[model samples]
Target chain A: MQMDKNSYKKYADARAKKSPCAKNCVCAFLFGGLICAIAQGLKELYMTFLKEDDAGTLVSVTLIFIAALLTGVGIFDRIAKHAGAGTLVPITGFSNAVASSALDAKGEGFVLGVGAKIFTIAGPVILYGITAGAIYGVIYYIVTLIMK
Target chain B: MENLIRIPKPVYILSSASVVGQHEKNGPLGEYFDIVGDKDDTFGCDTWEKSESEMQRLALSRALNYACMKDTDLEAILAGDLLNQCAGSSYGLVSFETPFLGLFGACSTAAEALLLSSLLCSSHMTRCAAVSSSHNASAERQFRYPLEYGGQRAPTAQWTVTGSAAFISTSCKDDFAQAAHNGEPVPVITEAVIGKSIDAGITDANNMGAAMAPAAADTLLRYFRESGMQPSDFDIIMTGDLGFEGSSILCDLTATEGLDISAVHCDGGLIIYNRETQDKHAGGSGCGCSAVVLAAQALRGIRTGQIANMLFIGTGALMNPTAIQQGASIPGIAHLIRITADIV
Candidate 1:
């Protein structure tokens, strides 16, 4: 029953067969690109009826709303299963997180359940994001004052 | 070396029940489950934690019902879950009014509970119930990522089962008393091999199958050697929630020991889900993964005379996030229990 370290390592290596990462990567890239293309198309359609800044904000809002709705209906999870990181790494992913937590905590009532648990995933993103932005603004002000 | 402990008296498994979530309900062994729930009705509770607790309660209640026993008749309930401080099981069984023993063996809680309950029954103790459960959302939020995050999962990552299983184990007195009325084959707990914690220096948190594979192989080898039994002795040898990768490693490691179990070897993780279709990366891995499969599928297989004997090796990765983040190697354990249809 005694196995040498070399043979054990070899056995471990044999067990750790690589999964189909290349195929997944290609699928992710293609699907991710397609999502961006659709977003751009939406932006273009909105630009014709609205100003540039309004269209930009509206496009993001539209995408997030769509993702949240999809998550609420349980479609986003199905998409995420096959889409992999393509569905993730986007604003849609953020909306899906918020929507899913809200749905999961819905039975606990709005105050303690949905109110507290809704931010379970997105809380860190907002906290660190604002903190980093404020810190950068302070550094920029200091550098400008020194240059002047 | 003296790992195998033979039961002095017969410990009969009277009845069992499995309650699974939506995904598991759609799996291959879906028909075997006692109760299947939808995604929204996951245990019909408020929170995922509460949902998991409800799963355990329902499973235990159903199992006892199958045995036609009430909570007052049981000596103690041995149960556990893949949650912080075993909260799922404790909260679930608190209302049952039965004495409880909460165990923590990670994914191997099923076999651990069974082994302990069987030992108690074999020693002339009153009948005991063994239960274990895991919720996908609850386990995911605690261990990896929350559902909403849509975090990119690695292929090594396994889906935690949202299910629970319970079994009623009694002494020969109760077994014979029941057999006079019931015509089902009595599945007896014959022997057990308690495993030692084996560390293979595996650190990846996602790749738990590999982390626990070495422990399973070690336990199986020791069980065969100590009990003086060979691979062909049992109809089937089952590993608890090892998934695909771990099962392969188990096969390779046991092969090196000159024991070929390829023909009869099976893994609960692998059998619980369809690896190709279900997005369950490697397969299912949780306390409920093996527990539900064993309670529903394997136990039924034993009862119907499809399988005469089986060895269930419950494997677990005994590493918390703190241990992993602090660079501690993931240690694994596997406990073995032999269940047979034939009377001893």
Candidate 2:
């Protein structure tokens, strides 16, 4: 491509040599959907032993535990490498993020290492997620009052 | 630093050596390396950073040994690495009595060291050593994530080469018949161009090749225009660690200026690893990428009479971890060094 100086970035982006492939997308879709289905199955299983809402929460806890364990055992990243976005589906992704950061920072000493750096990746998600949720709640309240 | 100009006097590379980790040892040029770290890629060190420094130390020592020289014989050691404050070079070469000059060119450290060493050898010093190293583990911990982190690297992400290469450069005018064994062909630095830092507005640290290709292109264009030399004039035109994406961009970028180097162009990043088996998506990168390839492959080729002359442009992304976190685009630089076999 005969690109001008200003268009170098566009030109470079056009030559996306190894972006996630179509196969990767399909794998992510399959893997992510499979995780959700398994979570659903776990929820139903928990429902037999607990209340309906408590079962849903228990399923989430189980998923996070599994993700953290996989990360510590050095398997989650390996799977992420091939699975691509498959492993990045919210609950699992968030768990992996926190666990990975904690593992990475553990060398510096617990107080500054694991304690301070545990939320390095997940911190931004939580901050922004809560902010957006509060804004949504306010809009929902206003909308409900106007409807009445 | 001299830019787009020939050195006042020729500097001959008498000897060189490469030390790599297990991954590079298992690479295509694996056997070409002088030494490889153990199965853990630690080189018997407790930490990855220390191992990186150790690689630099081993590289310089081996280079000196190959040249039949001693540590005291070295006038200076020009070494650098991809670490905070260039710790790899400083700590690794502390045992050497030679005066140390620490350098920081990111991935271009090796070429910058070689370029400066060549100039110093030609003018004032004799037996100047140029060493640069980068460890995958160390670089990852510092630049991206920790060793045990579970996030996947992008397909465009390049694997850092855990290796170091050292070159012994001396003035060709100096006499050294005693150390010259088997009448081996000497590798000489003929010309060099210091790269002007150029930012193509690329911010994705994972895709460094794209960020650096512009700098490589700029330097090559200058060398071609100033020296009035075509790419065909040399046996090969090589880049440091532009990897797959950067290599293609370089070819295209240069073509835009009516200079097509596709025929004679080669990349150190692509030369070191096997794409088929190794999971390195864009191939190997880092200072050691070009350093080892030049030592193990290019210099060997020069010694064996396969390549009479070649242009080596070492590309580097100059973004620090903090700068990337602040959303600053990566600015890249490529230092060019031309090497040839002595006619004698």
Candidate 3:
């Protein structure tokens, strides 16, 4: 039962089949690009009648709403299955996570279930993201002052 | 070879019951289950944890009713869940006032419970119950995210079954006679092989099928080798919840060992759901996945003489959120039990 590291590694390599990385990558890239293109087009449409800052925010909000709606109706999960990281790396994926958690908790009750679990998935992402950004900002300030 | 335990006396599976959530009830094996909860039947519990306890309570109640016995009639109860510290089983079966042996083998808890129950009944000459459950809400919150999170699931991810199942085993021959009189034939436990932990160094928590497949292959090979039985000896060799991907890996690994079980092999994960129509990417995984499938479907097949003998190996991935976050590999284990129908 005790195998050497080399033998175990070789055995694991033999037993674990190769995943279709090429297919997965192609799908992810194409789907992710297409989603970004759609967002770009939506922004363009809004820019025609709105201020530049307003158009950018409007486009992001529209994408999040669409993603949440798709997730609520169970369509986003299906897309994520085939799209893989393509659908996940986009802002829409974040919306999907929030929406799914809410829908999942809806059965328990709106207050404890939906309200509490609504940010379960997205909460950490936002928390770490802001922390990392602040840390980088402080480092940049120190570096600039030291150089001066 | 060291892990094998051959039952010296007959251990009769007198009766069993399965209760599943609405999603499973709509699946292919829906008709085989004893009870199917409605969409809101979260047992009216406010939390997924409480709902999971309700699932176990209901499943045990139904199984006892099927056997025409109460908690007083049972000597001991073996049960567990996917929750950390196994809160589901403790809270669920506490009211029964029966001595409980709480276990945690991830999704393999069902097989572990059943195997130990058979041993206890065979050695002590008493009746015991083995039960296990897993809820989609509870398991999801524990292992990954809450259901409402709508995070994109990896294609390799499996759907946790929202269900529970119970099996009543007794060494008393009179129980078999009563079971026969009631038109339910008993299945005898012949042997069990305990599995050693096999870590294939798989790091992805989402891809459980890959993490657990090696352990399943190792256990199946060991069971066949130690028992001196070929794949032809049993009608079917089923893995607990390998789903599509893990089942294939198991087949390929076993084939390398000169055992070809592709034709006689099936998976509980695959049997519980329709892959094409269900949208369950890799299929079902969890304690309830195999427990309910075997209780409701395979046992019925054996009782009706559709299946004569079966080798069931429950596979489990021994990993937690802390291990995954620390970048530790998932270690896996599998336990095997042989069940044979008693010829009338």
Candidate 4:
């Protein structure tokens, strides 16, 4: 039987299993919150030994290191599978994306493989992040100048 | 005149072998596979691509061994994989002395290869081997992401199966026909129907089942129309790499076509993994997913006198990273082959 694209999609959508958004959101909230709570605890502990700025920087470093290492050992993706946006919303996801790409490309060689592909997953985020920030900066600049 | 090309003579499945990785080995059809890979899923190769090639080699070698034939016995070998330039098949079959033909049917390579092999056997060649494979790590690196990438898999996303299988087909001339004459059941290829590529405006690469289901439905409808066969004529209708999502979509799509195939539909993707246990969200995919399942499960059933007749519909989504990025929707194809134990 012949079908237009719209009808085909309708048929597919009717049969295809829908992702449980409520369950996924709940899982993401709990896991993402837990990650933040850990970061908060780590910052408090680091604050005891160093300056506040240094401690904050160290927290970021620590999280990135743990995420990258966990990715290398192949534990991060497993958790991310269940955590969904929870693991991804945090700084850990960025590190996992980079580290995973680097590891994946190590076979082809350092230059073409690792260097070129290191940012493959995270490239869009960086590109859009910077572009959006610059646009927001122009808006802020124009508003502040008028205020002055 | 109908898309049906009835084989002038039967090309029976002589032997086949399956080799799989840790994930597949851990699944329900674990023991059915001929060979299982190492703990690292490397299959004794240093790289994922090489491991994939090695799987093809091992499976073909084992398949030939089971038939008590050498590489020299094959008139030609047809191999295909889901890699750029079909690297796995080209490199995998290099050592064999037989003439080689490389194919690229995405997940449908197994069936495509079989179609060619059957044609060759029915025409001139006495024996031909069809090898199809796919590796999860290699497929991931090429198509989606790194092996360790912490990206959450979509509910519609299918897990590329790490497996390979070789099917050896021989014309029913002398020795091959002996089993049938001796009153024993033999898996025989009766007819084949090549399908047209169909696009359903699906853009998500993860939901390949949706993209390919329409093509499968189109092919099934055409096969039914041309051959004058109903869904119940066959004991089962086996499909390649539709997984859970594709299988359901296929049923619904065909249902709309006024063909009720739900009662007899079995998909390679769904049978390979347990939904409750394996996190293969939708199910297993790739050329190997269907190839190995057909080699290990379906063939075994036919040999054991369980299945009388069956139809294999190899479904494939012909999309690449470049086209997907260029805003091109995935086009799909499904090739149909009728295999039967009953010569009548």
Top-DockQ structure, candidate number: 4
Better of 1 and 4 by lDDT: 4
Interface RMSD of each candidate, angstroms, one decimal:
3.6, 3.3, 4.1, 1.3
Q: How would you encode candidate 1's per-residue C-alpha lDDT over B1-344 as one tens digit per residue? A: 46789988888898899999988988999989999876664567767899999999999989888887888889999999989999999999988978899999999999999999999997858599999999998998778765655556767778899889999998855454643335657688999988778888777787788878888988888888888888898889999898888888789788978889999999999998898888788889999998999988888898887988999988898879887878887888899999999542
Fnat for each predicted structure, in order: 0.29, 0.56, 0.32, 0.85
lDDT of 4 by residue, A1-148 (tens): 5778887677666766777889889999999999999999999999999999999999999999999999999999999988989999899999999999999988889999999999999999999999999999999999999999
Model 2 misses residue A72 by how many Å? Answer: 2.0
Q: Which lDDT tens digits does candidate 2 get at residues A1-148?
A: 1235457777777777666578888989988888999999999899899999999999999999999999999888888876767888659989998998888777678998899999888899999999999999999999999999
The CA lDDT at B196 in model 4 is 85
Q: How close is every model to the real structure, measured as TM-score?
A: 0.88, 0.91, 0.84, 0.95
What is each candidate's DockQ, to 2 decimals? 0.34, 0.42, 0.30, 0.72
Better of 1 and 4 by DockQ: 4
Which candidate, 1 or 2, would have the higher TM-score against the true structure?
2
Q: In candidate 4, how many Å is residue A56 off?
A: 1.0
**Evaluated with lDDT, which candidate comes out highest?**
4
**Per-candidate clash tally:** 1, 0, 11, 0
Question: What Cα-based lDDT does every candidate model obtain?
Answer: 0.85, 0.88, 0.85, 0.90
Indicate the DockQ of the complex predicted as candidate 2.
0.42
Rate residue B159 of model 2 by lDDT: 96
> Best by TM-score, which number?
4
